[model samples]
Target: MKKYLIKKILSNNVVLVEKNKKNYVLVGKGIGFGKKKGDFLEDPKEIEEKFISLEGLSDFEYEHFLETTDPKIIEICNKIFEMASSELKENLNPKIHAGLIDHVNLAIKRLKEGIEIVNPFLFETKLLYPVEFELAEKAVSILKENLEITIPEAEIGFLALHLYGGRGNNDKEDALKHSKMMNRILGHVGKKLEIDMDKYPFDCQRLIMHLRGVINRVEKNQSLERSFVSKLKDEFSYEFKIAYDISKIMEKALKIRVPESEMGYIALHLHRLNSYKH
Candidate 1:
């Protein structure tokens, strides 16, 4: 059996352990209880399923986070991760641990201070990742049950974004940047149409879905071939102009060129949204 040497105890339920010269954070109920550094865990099976690899992470930074963060918050994050893994049927990116804990801790602090949390991309996030959004809803319930505090829907949206970003090989920072760019593009569309998107949830959802698809297609170098590009430009000059501007915004943020055909599709969506305004 592989033995683990206790390296550090973060909490009664969490510990840093070393095996084969690699470190991992072992999380389980009472895993660290009555344990100290240099102690050997003879049975690897005891924490076989609960260890998070610390590879590719800064040890100092992670240790500092565990030391400073509330243990209750860490426990909650672990619970959420376990639930997500079970439901998604896959292991999540362990890098999200520290980030989620920090985010939740700050959100709780803000709530205590009576500061309102708002998510401008709530609709977009939900539309983009329905499964993650559902998981986040469950996470909100977990937070409320444990902390005795109500988590706002805005926070749920943020949580969904985090969960979605943690899946597969997704980079959390890149996911967040993509969401921010989508928000900015929507903001531009709202400004150009002189309408508040919040008032039209369906339209906003459609636009966001289309934008996401456009982004995926553009990143994969897939361009749509449309015969009516000139017709779209001539018929909806105003909407096409706004779409062109949005393409530029996307190009700058994504560092990829937005095809004119894609701009035509965007213009059609814009036209539909503008029609709803009148």
Candidate 2:
């Protein structure tokens, strides 16, 4: 039997361990209790679960997640991703590891405290992504079985959105699409308006994040409330035109009409970017 040094205790049952210069997360009842950093695993039999960090989970982000999150939460998150990967025929995004654990932990806490937060996008999420919705429904079963907690039906749709975004293929494709769209928009503005946004990398990054949210909303057919489109257009005509051009691209690519309110928001961001350098 080999002794593993405890690096951190995430919960009473979960500990980050280091052996032979590699990191592993161990989960077992009482495995982490009474343990401190540099303490050896007293008994191997106490180990109920282990995730090898060297294998497909070496990123510092995952390491930090394993170190900070509860073991049971991590276990449940792993199970959800395992089931989703097998059912959907795609690898779930590793980043979802953190998000799911954090979400489910808070959700369990919220329910225990009698909080009832509604998922506003539940209907659209279910309608737009039926397959992921089904997977999330099944996930609720796993939660009920293991966590012994009943989640709201709307939670299924919320989980579906998370799972859908975390699918590896879709994640990569969406990233590529986002990058292409950002470049196209910047190129269009650079060529048509002759503004070099490359000089403002921070502003460009903010715009990228904004576009990411826009793409996600468009993909899910989510729209904002009506806004003062005419006033916005009048006040920020140049930025609004750029926003309109972006709307055209989004409409052409996603086959959904871009909402004027969303365009107004985009124009606001565009105006900020334009004002930064002009």
Candidate 3:
């Protein structure tokens, strides 16, 4: 790759570069030091942090972001996206660039100012978006290493939300609501049955997978009739009752009625988990 010129300085570490007649935004510590427009970097190869802009498209948000946001913050978020892309093997939505930069900037500012906020859906976020949560964890570590800032765990949850929005199909807020309901239902089952959910990883995973599918079905209004629901209820009364309790919570949390078949499937999972000795 040929070295690019400094077309403009967006920040102390961020600069606009042109290569092969396409514009790119480069971010690195001191990459833009004492540089002016039309001044080519002696080693553009040294600019390891950069994102290519969509060809011939005017991304006003990205442009405004480069001008207004801190380059260090942008650099941090870029590493996160790079990590996510590498791990997930998918191209994240470029639209997330500006939004994530803005979020990181504000998050850092709030942390430096000693203001803290809690994420009510933190647990749910971890369970629901495991991969994204991992990326967020790495992002926090990077911030600590580069900026010497210890971000709150709640911010990691928030960053996971941003990553989920950037990669997944569900609306970020709706996904959080769904995950919260699922966790609440699982918690209720464990309490009612007096079972240690951690002891039965397979059963727990099964329940989570079932509930995830249930959410999709419910959102699509796809009704599934369960002919064996009554039989299962009679055979496993305890698990059936726990399932009923979970159904109520889901109904309340999701504001959608859960079908008996769905409850029956969930009860089967609960039965298996409760029956396990460990």
What lDDT does model 2 reach?
A: 0.71
Residue-level lDDT of model 3, residues 1-278, one tens digit each, is: 45777788877777888877767777777878889999887445556446634343466854765666777777777787888888889977766666677888988888889898678767667777788899889888988888987888998898888888778464667767776786687678778888766666566766877777887898898967799999999998888888888878878887888888888888888878877754
Off by over 4 Å in 1: 44-46, 109-120
**How high is the lDDT of residue 99 in model 3?**
68
Report the C-alpha lDDT of model 2 over 212-231, residue by residue, as the tens digit.
67877877889876658889
Q: Is candidate 1 or candidate 3 better by TM-score?
A: 1
Candidate 1: tens digits of C-alpha lDDT, residues 177-201: 7778878888888898999977987
Prediction 3 TM-score vs. true: 0.72
In terms of lDDT, which candidate is stronger, 2 or 3?
A: 3
What RMSD, rounded to one decimal, does every model reach? 2.3, 14.2, 5.1
Candidate 3 stretches with Cα past 4 Å from truth are 1-8, 16-49, 52-68, 194-203, 217-225, 251-257, 275-278
Best candidate per lDDT, number? Answer: 1
